[model samples]
Target: MKTSECMLCPRQCGVDRSVKFGFCGESEEIRIARAAPHMWEEPPISGTKGSGTVFFSGCNLRCIYCQNHEIAVSHLGYAVTADKLLRIFFDLQAQGVHNINLVTAGHFAHQLIPILRQAKADGLRIPILWNSSGYESADTIRMLEGLIDIYLPDFKYINPKTAKEYSNAPDYPETAKASLAEMVRQVGAPQFDSQTGLMTRGVQVRHLVLPGHAQESRQILWYLFQTYGNGIGYSIMNQYTPMPQMKDHPLLSRKVTAQEYENVIRYAKQIGIENAYTQEGEAACESFIPKFSGQPQ
Candidate 1:
């Protein structure tokens, strides 16, 4: 599944990654920013031990307010062979992490598939999680059918104009909707280990409430609840921290207001979103963003 034409993402730039870069700003070579235990995910994912997270470089979406701009936009990471990545997975699993979380990995799905299959064959018992921006093609998601156990995807926008203005992907609403459906089809419902309370399999859709986009957040919550009907988990995030690059921007220059977060949270409850997780107290602080050292630890 080498991405010779490089249509692995929604961009479908069609550039031969062997020669040049695609819209994701990445070549065929695998580049990773960090591989370590991450504790900031939803409780089911992070658990008490933490999720073994691998932060890949480059992104298909160009959100102006992206928190990980240093690696996503600037591509601050070192290259590693697929063999090295396989080793990193086992190393993380050995750390007793709850799961192996792959962050922003849609761009490298083709290359990572064989590695994932190999890891599972080699007795890697932990659940593999795909944490992604919602700008994914359903076809790309289909490629991950049996490989991924948990799907952690963001439902960023329900409005085309809002998606265009923020992530520069006007088709985000429809694209995310289709991809999310594919995710649900792959993982039927949420399942947890009865002993540890950690998620074992399923889809968890996350939505970060923008500072002034409370209505959009409400639309997204209502849409998820009405469409999926608690078939999947929901994470209503209140951690939209304004990056330094957005210091001059109008709407994204500041953190999400408490009222804005509360309104969305209240709407989620009113809409009968029972299987959900809501953030509380100082979640918008910059400390939540991980420090991206150039190489995997």
Candidate 2:
């Protein structure tokens, strides 16, 4: 199948990606940055083993403070056929991962459908997680209704102005709200395996507490709790690191303050949001960034 003028995401960058690359720097082919067992995800998603992570290259929203800017903005990666991607999945499965995680795959949605179908047919029994930035279109999400088993989406911003300043996308908050509603509609609530503690099917909403954005984080959590009402899982993250390019931005130049993260967590408890996960002070350390030096077959 050919890639359309590719308004797959909210970007709607009408550059005929079938012939040439769009604003995302990728064409019809699937470009991957890394394929390996990632252990740094949330407890249920990562478990005692690991999550089979396939980090796709290019992104619709290039946030200035993005940690994975190498793959997200710079497009530092190579293209691989769907067949090769399936092979990598099977290889990772053999390595004993709990689930297959597809990170930042919104731009390449059409291309991933067939690849996932083939992997499912070839004895890929683990749950498939659609991990993405919250900037998604409802129509694009509807296309993935039954294919995705777990939804791990980030609710980046509560206000459009903050989104525009940080990610150059003014519609981030609106798009994310609609897209997350669709995700919840598809996967009703968080379901887990009793013995393994691994997630089976659910929508886990992640909110990274940005420095100087504690109020925004509180609003986002309140919105999520009000909308989903314990039907969704929440992972409150505190791993915001200042990348080189963010040194000039006033808010993005430092790590999230302890008070900022604490306030959000406190708000979550006040709202009676029980199924929430949080990190401590040491989580701000840069030791979490995984080495993307390709996966062993």
* Index of the highest-lDDT prediction: 1
What clash count does candidate 2 reach? 0
**Candidate 2 structure lDDT:** 0.89
> Candidate 1, residues 1-297: lDDT per residue as tens digits?
556888888788999999999999999999999999999999989999999999999999989999899999997999989889999999999999999999999999889999999999999999999999888999989989999999999999999999989888999999999999999999978899999999999999999999888999999988888899889999999888898889999888988888888898888888888888989858888899999989657
| lDDT (Cα, tens digit) per residue for candidate 2, span 1-297 | 577777889988887787888877789888889988889999899997899999988988888888888888776777888888889889889999999999999899998887888788888999999999989999999999878999999999989899999899999999999999999999989999998778999999999999999999999999999998899999999999888888888888999988888999999999989999899888887778875654333
**TM-score of every model?**
0.98, 0.97
Instruction: Give candidate 2 regions above 4 Å deviation.
Output: 294-297
**TM-score for predicted model 1 compared with the true structure:** 0.98
Model 2, residue 100: displacement in angstroms?
0.3
Worst 10 residues of 1 by lDDT: 1-10
- The CA lDDT at 53 in model 1 is 96
